[model samples]
Target: MIRCRQFYLGYPNSATVSHLLTWSHWIELLKIDDVLERSFYEQQTLLERWSVRELIQQKESALFLRLAASKDKAGVLQLATQGQQIEQPADLLRKPYIFEFLKIPEPYQIAETQLETLLCDHLQPFLLELGKGFTFVGRQYRITLNNRHYKVDLVFYHRILRCFVLIDLKINEVQHQDIGQVNMYFGYFAQEENIEGDNPPIGIILSRNKDELLIEYATYQMNSQLFVQKYQLYLPNQEDLRRELELTLREGTENASQSAKTLLDENDDT
Candidate 1:
C-alpha cells in the first residue's frame, strides 16, 4: 500500500497545516513538483476554496504558467491567492490560448465556419479554454450597418468583466487589417448594440500567428477594447512550454533588476 508518509513527514505539525489548508488541499498540493508551484496551488486552494476537481483542472492546465505569462512572480502569487480581480484592462488578455479540446489536427486547417461549428459542438471544454465566467451568447452573432449585415464568429459575455466579448476568427496570421476590422466591431457594439450601463464591448481577433510587435503597437494605439491572441489547435507540448517559461521568467526578473538599478543610479546622480 502506498502511504503519504513522506507528505506527513515533511509537515509533521498537523495543527499548523490544518490551520492553513484542509486535508483535501494538502492532497492536491502533493501532486505539484516545485516548492513554489505547490505553494501557489496550496494558497489558491485555501483562499479560493476550490474543490478537489477544480484544483486538478488548474494543475492539469498549467494555471501557474498561464498567469505567469503576463505577471511577475509576486503578481502571479497574488493572483493565485487573491483570485483574478480584473482591475486593469490587461487583466482580461491571456495570450496563446490553447484549444486542445477542439480535437483538430495540424496540417489540416479549417475555416472560420468549421472552427465555429467545432467549438459549438465542444462547448463545455471550449468554455474552460475561454476561462472563467464566460457565457456563450451565440455564434454568428449578427449586426447591421449601412443596410449590410455582418456576423461575428463567436460571442460571449464575461460575467466578471461585465462586457460583451466579440471574437473574430482568422486562419492566417493576424494582420493590421484584422485589428482594424475588430476595432470597427468594437465601435459598432459600443455605439449601437450595448444596453444601458454595460461596459464597452471588448474585441478579440483570434488567429494562429501575429506580428508580436504589431499586435502590441496596434492594440495600444487603437481603442483599449481591442486585443489580439493566438490559438493552437493541438495541445502544446507542456514540457517545452515549461522550459521556455523558465527562461522567460528569468529574463523578466533580470530585466526588472537592471531597470531598478538604472533608476537608483540616476536618482543618486541627480
Candidate 2:
C-alpha cells in the first residue's frame, strides 16, 4: 500500500533490506505508525528472529513503550537504531513485567507455593517475558548455611550477563526484610556458586506491589545488585504506557535543558 511504500522510502537506511525478516513480519510491523517504534520492532525482529506471532504479541503488549519509559531521548533513539543492547545488568530488567499467560483469576490472593507452581507450569512464556539470555537452572533451589536450609523461589543464569539471577516471589508488597534476605542470597551465590568467569549474582523480588520509599531505604548503601519489581497477572494498558513514556521523555528533556541553561548562565557570570 501507499503507507508501506512510504515507510520504506522514508527510512531507506533501515534494517528492512535484511533477509532476516519475512513479509509476514513486515506486515505486522507495518501496523505501527510511529517511525521510531516501527524501527525498534524491525531491529528487534532482525536481532531476535522473533516469529510473526511473537512480533505481533510484543507490539500488542507495547514492549517498546515499556523499555523506553526509563530512558532519556538518546537512549530511546538508540533503541530504535540498535534494538536492545544488553551490555549491562540493568538493561535486562523490565518494569511491571507482564504475566497474562499465568491466567490467574480475580481476588488474586494466591499462596506463594501456588504462584511458583503456576510460573513453573508456564516456564516457556515466563522466560520469553523475562527477556533474552536467561536459562533455567532450578526451582526451590536449596542453599544451606549454619545447618539451616533455605530455598530460593526461582533460579536462572543470564548468559549475557554471565551471572546467576535469583528471584523471590512475594504475594504482597516487598518488605525491608525481603531485601535483606535476597542480599543474603546474593552473598551465598557470589561466594559459593560463582565460578571463574561468573559475575556477582543478582537478586530480584517479584511482588504484586512495591513501595518505592521502602525499597529506596532498604537498598541504601547495599553492595549487591538487587531489584524489586512489580508483576501483573494481566496485560498492561498500552495507552497508559504510552502516556507514561511521553511524560518520562518530556521530563528528561526538560531536565537536560535546565542543566545546560545553568551551565551557560554560570559561564556568562564568569
Candidate 3:
C-alpha cells in the first residue's frame, strides 16, 4: 500500500500510473530479481505492447541475455527502449539458433530431406526459432540462371527487416563449401529476386554442428552476410541456458575492459 501510494506520488502521469497498478504487469516484473533487467522488460512491454503470453515467452527464451551476449555490445538502454532493433546485419543473427521444436532424436543422423520435411511440417515452431517477423516463402524454392537450376532449402521474408532470407540445411558439420554455396544462393537472390525496395538477401546455413575453426578461417575475409549456425534436436536445458548466459555476460564485461585498456594504451602511445 505504501509502495503503491509512493509510486502514485513519485510519478503522476495517468498512463504510467495505470501500468504500475496493473496487477499482471507488476506480477511479470516481480519475476525478475535484477532491477535493471526488470525495468528493461517493463519498457519492452510498453513499447512492444506484448501480451501476457508474449512476456512469458520473452522471459523463457532469455531474449535480453541472448541479445546482450552478442559481440555488438547492445547496452541495457538498447534492450529496454529499442525493442529488438535491427541496426545492422549481425543484429539479426543468433550464435546458436535453437531448433528443439523439430522433435528429431539427438543421436539420429537424419537426412537433409527428412529435416526439411520436419521443419515444414512444424512451420509455426520453425518461425519462432527463425525469430520475429519472418513469413515463410517456400521450401526448396527454385531459381534458374544461365540455363542451370538452383534450389534454396528454405526461403523466408523478414517483414521487419524487409529482406529475403535463404536458409540451407546441412546434416553434417559446417564446411567452407557450405559458406560458398550459401553465398551463391544470396548472389542469385540479389540479382534476380531482390527488387528495388528489398534489402540484399541474407543467407544462413543450418548445420548439425558448427566448425568454429573452419568458419573463422574461411569467413575472416568474407564480406557476405552469410551465417552458419548449429541446430540441436532437443530443447536446451533451462539451467544450461542460465549458465551460458552468465558466462557470456562475464566474457562481454572482460572484452569491454580489454577494449578500453587498448584504447587507453593507444592514446598514451600517440
Best by lDDT: 2
Question: Model 3, residue 135: what's the lDDT?
Answer: 95
Between candidates 2 and 3, the TM-score winner:
2
lDDT scores in order: 0.75, 0.87, 0.72
lDDT of 3 by residue, 26-129 (tens): 67766676654666677766655666766776676666655555533345446655556665666677656666656567477778999899899989667765
lDDT tens per residue, model 1, 1-270: 132775776577766664556566677787676766776777666645567776776677676666666776567657655656565556766657777766677677688889878888998767766666689998998888999987888999987777898988888888777887788888788888788877888887888888898888767767876778787776566687677567766877898899999999999999
Q: Model 3 lDDT vs. the true structure?
A: 0.72
Where does candidate 3 stray beyond 4 Å? 1-26, 40-50, 72-77, 105-109, 237-270
Q: How far out, in Å, is residue 252 in model 2? A: 4.4
Error of 3 at 13 (Å): 8.5
Query: Candidate 2: where is the Cα deviation over 4 Å?
Result: 1-16, 252-270
TM-score of 1: 0.80
Residue 222 of candidate 2: its Cα lDDT?
Answer: 96
lDDT comparison, 1 vs 2, better candidate: 2
- Give each model a TM-score: 0.80, 0.90, 0.75
